[model samples]
Target: MNTSHQSFAYTLHDVTCLFRKHFDRRAIRYALTRAQWRALKAIRRREGMSQTELAEFLEMEAIAVGRVIDRLAAAGFVERRADPNDRRCWRLHLTSRAHAVTDDMEVLASELRREALAGVSTADFEAFERVLGKIRSNLSAIESGTEAGAEFTSS
Candidate 1:
């Protein structure tokens, strides 16, 4: 194995950490914690998702996501509507205020993305994305035990 290839996982982790750190710093002005902003973005993507569904999508505990939703609701960024089909469940919706804030967030995120991709050629970026997508698919398969490392072999 190439020694440089061994560092791929570390490099990926470092890049993700740095991106989140930079976003956290830049997002501070919005007066929302990272979790709050993340939840808001997730909710925006799929409006009227149940809290349980949101928790699963966010990969967060139900209780923790509940608190994030609570804070967002208090801030007038979200509203909970009773689910008619499931009387005990609440369907989440973004308020008009949240739509405005998320629009601003989208602009801020675009600026950050542009800054991160600076000097990268479009073809190179596209290739990078393709590779990452493959990696994600492989990992998901492994996690589900559908692949079970069946392709592994001695070099």
Candidate 2:
């Protein structure tokens, strides 16, 4: 690649690295990995979500989701109950400890987000969100093979 292209790639990698570093440092006090925290928040939004549903919502693989659940369960941050209507499925629920951690996590995340967007105005933020949404949609369409006239497909 050209020098400019290589520089852009390194910049992107640095941004990703910094984001993960900050998130891990802040989230460690809650005794959760980033994935575990995301799963917990999703469960809090809609309790009793099946593993498959959680995986779909997070755009993650079922096995990866299961690993997060396992860690959270072992730490007493979540409970996995057998789905009443489907014996084959398990429903996820946040424990009391998880709820307590969520409040602090919310504050920490908000502060971090504020710092990240320190100079951005509300309008700018909204525009950024819209652009991000479009990018996400475009990537999803490509991944699903639904872009242009292609039929829907999944990897």
Best by lDDT: 1
Could you tell me the lDDT of residue 8 within candidate 2? 49
TM values, all candidates: 0.92, 0.76
What is the per-residue lDDT of model 1 for residues 65-119, given as tens digits with 9 covering 90 to 100? 9999999999999999999998999999999999999999998889989999999
| 10 residues in a row with least lDDT, candidate 1 | 146-155
Q: What is the C-alpha RMSD of each candidate to the true structure, in Å?
A: 2.7, 6.1
* lDDT (CA) per prediction: 0.89, 0.83
- Backbone atom clashes (below 3 Å) for every candidate: 0, 0
Tens digit of per-residue lDDT, candidate 2, span 1-155: 34454474477579778877887798886666778888988999999999999999999999999999999999999999998998999999899998988888888878888887889899988976765566578778779898633332323
| Top TM-score hit | 1
Off by over 4 Å in 2: 1-16, 146-155
